[model samples]
Target chain A: MHSIPGRRLIMGLFLIFLLLPIYWLVNMSFKTNAEIVSTMTLWPHTPTLQHYKRIFTDESWYSGYINSLEYVVLNTIISISVALPAAYAFSRYRFLGDKHLFFWLLSNRMAPAAVYALPFFNLYSAIGLFDTPWAVALAHCIFNVPLAVWILEGFVSGVPREIDETAFLDGYSFPRFFIKILVPLIASGIGVAAFFCFMFSWVELLLARTLTSVHAKPIAAIMTRTVSAAGMDWGLLAAAGVLTIIPGALVIWFVRNYIASGFALGRV
Target chain B: MDKTVNQKAWFLVLPVFLVVAFSAVLPLMTVVNYSMQDTFGNNQFFWNGVGWFKELLDPSTDLGGRFLASLGRNLFFSMVILAIEVPLGIVVALSMPRQGWTVAACLVILALPLLIPWNVVGTIWQIFGRPDIGLLGYVLNAIGIDYNYVSNEIDAWVTVIVMDVWHWTSLVALLCYAGLKSIPEAYYQAAQIDGASRWAVFKAIQLPKMNRVLLIAVLLRFMDSFMIYTEPFVVTGGGPGNSTTFVSIELVKIALGQFDLGKAAALSLVYNLIILIVCWIFYTVMTNAGVERKVQAESEPAAKPKSSAALKPATALKPKEGVA
Candidate 1:
């Protein structure tokens, strides 16, 4: 690739802009509340892990992470599983109402979670799924499923139809072909789809907060509520904030090679 | 790319249809129901039939005034965010390192902000903007800028907008980078051979290659920013005198804060409709772009076969996908 002038400087400055606030959060997490309030220190003068320790020791604090992960994992699985077949169909066939169905799905992806939060609360509660990981997981499917389908369809389309015809001619059953031949061929696509499912579900707050109360409260919700109840314990809030970024960071690292292509939804 | 007319393919889509229906259709019906009816205290309810809708649309009414104001704010915010983030994102994407470990490091850092929970993003800025303890606020004050995100309308808007730019610009950059990566090296070789100016090269080659992803980026950014709730809600709490309240914030306040279900439901429908219309426009434009590209590819092969082979994959993959 041809190099642009001052590209390094431009990139360097943008990276710093992104990292500075995060560095502050991490910096604040390690400082005591007294130090946080008393001084504007770039680095924690008396660096401590008390906030981290508190989160680990408190059931309410720790369970929040587990709850968030449980629902996020559940939602990712549900979204990707359903999306796989749908993506194949969309990519390969002209089914009845295919265009309308596809548009409807995309519309749901654009639907504001705030619009759905109340009805989800009512629907989930009526179904006795409220305040469970299941409620949050299912609610998230409204968006994630559409996105998974959209991404996976692009990847599935990239695979030549010749592959499917070959599998069928070789006497492979549809399910077996999907699993044994097709799935492995588009494994990266699935990875990309799952990554997005995980990302959106993990980061979302409005529906997750509405659908769960005590039993399945996500860490994000817990962070907000605890901050309000306990007052601004900046250290604890920052620690919790730092912890939330870890799962995402780890996921991104594992998919680092695919990040750009994945962000393109595999179309690139 | 010829698709068979296989209606049996609907079976493949059944699982998705059922799940999304159970999640989307059911809730939407309930919203429609609530939107048309008024609720008294308790489980007692009576038919108000379009009353809420009337009140919602009329600017003289309290609900209408708040809705219109917040809707305007949301539109302005989305416009501002796109204006700043799009060019900056393209610049950042262009500036991305061509190879090696720095590429990985930069990608990871660029993506970091996007993955943080929205409220935490808000909280980060909230703390990072406090004049007493936050580095950003403290340094600005020390420099005699007299900046505080709280208690000042313009300061609050600036903080929210900057925070959004921080949170989402990476997404735009990542999408553009992906677009740029797909451009064949041959295009650049041709540009260099022709002694193309940098501006001409970008305008002809890079910008065209980046068009599809740029559209996706804009659509996603616009939709998400228009429906923005969590971050600004956390940072400003729609405060410093409701100066930064967007439609979502106001809707939430009506729905959950005040428990005015009827008005909230009506507002929700309108808010969702606006997004749907805008989304439809983008979908149409994007699909049209794909069609236009396909025509170009077909005609270009007849005109000059040499470059068509390189252009095929980029154009072929451009269609049949919606927003991420």
Candidate 2:
């Protein structure tokens, strides 16, 4: 409690630093181009929903949202499923090369995405997986799966082994035992890992854009294409950017309670 | 409890191994293949046999020079980010309240910036740094400083660094905060009994306990910063005369801009190796610290397991079973 005043001052500074960009972004979304270019206004005098309206009505801008959503969801599901058993194995068994294998899996996350971009683009297209949701989904798995494994491994390890044995002793088969006993123990962990997968996959644009042109382009890509003959549509772009935040915000809101604690567990 | 699970544990990990290998090994092989070969469209190849690697490693070549320059800039960016964010994160974490909804709220706010996509972060800064309407830009110009991120090298670097700090400092702060929260109150109480100063308590208690997580934070931030591309790409297009171009940005230019698959592939491999080495070194140091902590903590541990017992209420909790 002695640190109250000091804490407040630090937090106040943090709030300003964190929120200023968001404020500017929201402010710019409402202003007209003429206003944007001519002079700086702290807040738009004439706020309009025109940009938001444009994002919804315009097919080009609208589909980026759709594409991003489809792939991000796909990426999350695949990564989590793969990570589950892997994490369980690492937690439960001391197999040959287990430590080395786990470390090797994590090293994939450290691989520069730029190095793989060209190879992925070429390889996916050659196999007819390019320009599809699965390509991006698969690409994201390279890194996200390892992260999911590392995180969930922590959660799974913390669950007592007695739980697994008891379920088997109760005459449950291995599959039934795992489904009924093991998963619920680590639900918060899975949720936290899933949220991260979704966030990373959603935010990724370079590979998403480079891999697809029209059929699978994401909203980030759509924003890039919006600068047409009419010129850069600041209002519309800002609106689309704002809308992009919604899905992510919803995810954060849902998992906000567990995130801190889950991280604490995962780090251990 | 039994000491062993069945050998069938290998079966559980097999599927993941295959999926990750398919995702990682095959692509990496392809990159390796491309790196060693010379092609002039139409799927044609000439066995170059380390030609591209040699050229890149040499200082005289254009690609080599660019590679070194990008690597230097990447290292510089990582250093700058660590310097600003680590200490700031410590300060923020030190100031954060210990318990209740206020702590949770601060954490949620800290997590918000981390959730936004990389490109969006770049876009936000792009719009937010506009001198005409941007608050920062407007204020800077109002103060008689000529600020233009797109045209000026120093301004571009400044903007990129500031944006990176804003977006990532939260991660450090949160990790440090988590480290701080794990410190039991008995340490503080003991310190109070000893009449220890705030700085002394921090140095002796909190700092040593936080060393492990802080190392993780530093490693993650450094690797991410070294590999950064999307934000700087969107904001400055790696322009203002390449002052803001990092390794990832350079790799993208070689691969996408020039379509030089061979050179790009070689460059990518080199970049990946560099990141791997640095990260491996970081992990080794951190693990060593963990060993030291274990040795140190054994002497004067804080709190009973009762504090964590609250999380595992045996009677209240339900059994869970599912594949995931």
Task: Provide the overall lDDT of each model, using Cα atoms, as 2-decimal numbers.
Answer: 0.91, 0.82
Query: For candidate 1, lDDT tens digit of each residue in B113-218?
Result: 9899999999999999999989889999999999988899999999999999999999999999999998889777655545555666677778888999999999
lDDT of 2 at B105: 79
lDDT of 2 by residue, B19-135 (tens): 889878988999999899998999899999999999999879999999988888889989998999999888888888766888767777788888888888998998888887678
Clash-forming residue pairs, model 1: none
Query: Stretches of candidate 1 above 4 Å error?
Result: A228-230, B305-324
- Poorest 10 consecutive residues of model 1 chain B by lDDT? B315-324
Scanning candidate 2 chain B in windows of ten residues, the lowest lDDT window is: B315-324
Interface RMSD of 1: 0.9
- Model 2, position B188: C-alpha lDDT score: 65
Sorted into a CAPRI-style docking class, model 2 comes out as medium
DockQ of each: 0.84, 0.61
Candidate 2 collision pairs: A64-A219, A179-B321, A179-B322, A180-B320, A180-B321, A181-B320, A181-B321, A182-B320
Clashes of 2: 8
What value does the TM-score of chain B take for model 2?
A: 0.89
Which candidate number maximizes DockQ?
A: 1
